[model samples]
Target: MMKEGGCRPRAASPLKWLTQRPTRVTRAWCSGPASPAPADLWSTLKKALFIIGSSTIVFVALRNSLTYHLQHFWGASGDFWQHQWDKILHTYGDNPFTFMVYGTTIVSYVVYWTVGLLYTFVDMTGYPAILKRYKIQPGTNEPVETWKLIKCILWVNFNQIFVGVPFSMACFYLLRLRGWDESRQLPTFHWVIIELIICILMEEIGFYYSHRLFHHRMLYKHFHKMHHEWQSPISITAIYAHPLEHALSNMMPVFLGPLLMGSHVATIWLWVSLALLSTLNAHSGYHLPFFPSPEAHDFHHLKFNQCYGVLGVLDLLHGTDDKFRASKCFSRHLMMLSLVPPREAYPDVLPKGKVIRGKQCYDQPSEDSQ
Candidate 1:
């Protein structure tokens, strides 16, 4: 609120200063509320630190154990290359059951826990305080119910392990049956990059249309409504949705890209992991510096009709975010323009004032001019 090199005199009473923003009930109706204080934030951070420490220890142990098992299975014998070819590529890759188990286990842990734990850490570490400190729009000041948050975590884990993994293996097996497996050429870094770009394009286009469909009057009330319940969502809420919506709107887009591209299995896994991280970041709730801000998607959850796409290109073309762009949520950062010094901002102009005023200097006849 402060202008460049300018200050307002304090209000006479402490109550006047406290009542300046809005009453609690009134603020609940509008998007973008105040943040918590530093002391409250510090308390939350201690809990987050403990969770993070424990998770790290568990993850390290899991990684070491998996590595030892994988090495024993594939590399312990004299011929490492032969063992990898026979057991991993030939046996695991070709068989649907083996592939599904391997895919689900690895993907469930890497993508699910990576995004889930990070979300938990940020949410616990006072993301609301961060949002408030930055004056970001539609900030989530209140806490979510612990039981509901835990339920979201469990559902997402289940979706990844049971639905997502099995579906992926089925797609692969179908492709193999159709001789698509023949095109699974050895992937170089360049091809992998190209595949990733193609995957993003495919996903953006697919998700844009599919997501818009979910916003339809009839569909929204049934399937997509569950996800919209959380306007200011935490990270796990990215994947938390009705099962039908999760499969059709969420998983299908990701699966389609790799299938269309005939990507190697490793490439598909890599893409999915990165895509999960992208979605998680988009729903992270915090406006942390150097991180992707979830303002657009968050606006969608609050406004309920705009910003349906991931990349937002389709939204821009369709003018979906027009109302959102005009709202306080989108314009909060623009308020910082008031902080730019007029002198430096207008370097070509010369001042000819007898006295300086707030944010402006008026031209006046000086002694030299007379």
Candidate 2:
């Protein structure tokens, strides 16, 4: 079976502490059979129009709703100041049940559905035939496993059960017994300060590793592939994952936090907030002016099978980042990706594997491609 293998040299560190160079992957494997297109990118104009338009509507609506609700609850917009207890040194009395339970359920739902409808709307409209564009995802003509999909969705959404709930209740109620009941110290060190930091650190590292492993060929088909079902039209539907992946991907922030004794209410707020917004933006498929676009992960969805770390740092560090120097997933926007010729595009590693069957013949037709 024909195969491809190569490794490019690592560039200088974008981050400060550089003790080791990243080990890059430069091989494409083809399944025993054929697959569809080489790539899965949408038109610049259409992709821009669709994902961006939907985001604006959702952003505005969600912001407005959140504001309206917060005002209804606290007589003003919900921000750090909302937690102020009339005195500067007073505690932040936030209801964990509200934010952790009601708040998340509400936000992920609204934000998710907005994204979902947007994608569906785009698909229904005469948009650039995105699904078929790059043969972007070789979703099986095999009937969608409806039962399995539903099971996965329910299990995936219960992430907080494992991550947020037990840990928050047990550690805060049992180990620390520190609830934000009025006299909660105003953003100062809590009873479980060390655990909070440790939990977040471990979880972040765990998230990074699990994410990378999901891209491994064996795991991708069984678990991670469902998330990539729609290429250019990334929306809220993108959040759900395999029930099996629930332990790995979903409840991480919660479970790891507790194990590390992260039992504070405020710290939990910050982490949860970031998790919500970040996950929404992950499917945005384009970057914001002040933030990395949805394209960061969108790039992952396209010519997938490589580049699996978050915030572009770990992936960049380990040389797993295939966006620029290694893989051609960004072939759709070579102009944006190309800084110079790839002298080591396919450095010889003498890789051993079957022909990366489907990928080579899968990309869109263009002057630069084979």
Candidate 3:
């Protein structure tokens, strides 16, 4: 304690160490699950079951999503998925998010499938029944044909698949030859887990800014408007953005990997999961007890230029959340007004509103699940 460098020791502080080694323990722990923790077996079972169930729900929706450009692009395994999975089985790590148990690729598939079907219904007769039933606040009243909307959706997602798939495969092959992806299949699970977490952090930063850019007034009028078509009424229109916007938004995860570290399959899987979940949920349009809903995004669509992040934090940090604050404040005021007389616990009426242009407010909507 009395040493000259005692206050400024070379040894790192615990927090610093943990921060540096995010996978510190996970890597060590997964070497082999040989030493069983003495915790109740039932408890571990419950936790495992919970994780599996949650991952399944997300995957189911994502898996059902593939009806865009190719009605029969792959072949006769069953659908395109059969062909895709066959490829994945033959090349496990090579098959996109196969390595990621709750992979984003699957989730994206769900998102596309769900939206495609929804638009299909509305397109045949031009009725957004789904949107009308659940949407919080109404955005544009433009009549979007179902088939037309599908085409837009296809163009956007396909942009990523066409470009990013090849892009990733190229990167993967290059990284492998350089002997990068080869050594990490069994990285201390801890490091793998840590790397996953780090990838999330990095992607969050990348996505937040990228999402906000599309909201810029100039950009909004161009391709972005295509997406915000059905605000209150949930529409397949979520990913129906102009191809440029879609390309940029969907590829945030891909862009982040190299900036922070070498390209790794683990990183890709983790990134895919986060992106798919956030994107799909953002547009899932279903309000849940635990998570934010499409209405959360309905708010943004009604009043663009706010609500930016996948989860909604960046806006708060960057002094951009005033729109959300002011809207919530007014809505709360409206609730108070609707109250005073009866005070019966009010029903939630604040989903979205008629579209309105305004100052950039709300730090940024967390489009994480959008």
Candidate 4:
């Protein structure tokens, strides 16, 4: 080597040679390619299945024990309801559909106003620091005007009376045509559970598809745009929508499951109450302790295109929740375990670097910016 060029090539050092390898190869080895979407989806699905299965087993076990202990109480309650139903039937000329319409309307009013007004009060007043800390999206309720609130209240009531009454009648008749037995005695706990599960599944499927359909460009302006008026909805805003959307997307999904199952009138009443409570909670704008987190639906309200389904199963399957899953809110998305503010309650989950205000999460700026 020295004879040819009048210089000797330095002996290659193994460590130096290794260090000089292609940077790309080294980087690639250290940080592998991102996991494929399908693998991530499968993992999500597995987690969901495990949670659902475990919950179902626990629910069944608890229901069995509770039903056995409360059999006499249930019997007494059923009898009391039957006596009340007799009076209602007599007053309404034995029209079960009329009873159903009246019952449903009354239940809706009670649940809506009781829960909705409490939330509205908080929205306007922002009092009782106890409840304020759990406020999922801050600053949303602060700027809402009183007249706008009143307008929403009036329109919601009007919808319940006009659109809701007719729709209830139609649903009752449809169930009748399908041979639903309105005169059946109070349903057994087992039958109620089975019917409820079916109803929930049907409602989830119907709501997801119909809700997504309403978001279509051709349909949204005329049918569903009103519902989206409240980007950060309060409890009362759950049913606030165009009459058409309320009928097809909101009411129909809740009714479809019961209709298909031919559930008893008593069971239907129970279902209606539970469904109303669930929706109110979702739209309440507060993520209180011991309640299901409203984050998913809240995110839907904020983003508009994601989390279209109630339980998120459909959204997950369809990848509509991809953005939601990536969000900071998702990291703090567990049910509130303590009464304290989420920041204090779950310090580990929501580290101090960022804060959630309204629909946005960002790093804390200086006090002047605040």
**Which candidate would rank higher by lDDT, 1 or 2?**
1
Q: State the lDDT of candidate 3 residue by residue for 44-125, as single tens digits.
A: 4565467658966886566535432223443343344444545655665554334432344455556556655654454345
Q: Candidate 2's C-alpha lDDT?
A: 0.46
lDDT of 1 by residue, 153-210 (tens): 8878777767776666677676566544333234554466668878887888888888
Models 1 onward score TM values of 0.61, 0.48, 0.51, 0.80
Instruction: Indicate the residue-level lDDT of 263 in model 4.
Output: 81
Sort by TM-score, top down from the best = 4, 1, 3, 2
Q: Flag regions of model 2 displaced more than 4 Å.
A: 1-183, 188-204, 216-221, 231-233, 253-263, 326-370
Greater-TM-score candidate between 2 and 3: 3
Best by lDDT: 4
| Clash totals in order | 1, 17, 37, 0
* lDDT for each residue of candidate 2 in 132-200, tens digit (9 for 90 to 100): 222222232122345644553464456544533443444444324433333354344323344545665
Q: Each candidate: what lDDT?
A: 0.62, 0.46, 0.48, 0.76
Better of 1 and 4 by lDDT: 4
Best-first order by lDDT: 4, 1, 3, 2
- Alpha carbon deviation, residue 143, candidate 2 (Å): 20
Ranking 1 against 2 by TM-score, winner: 1
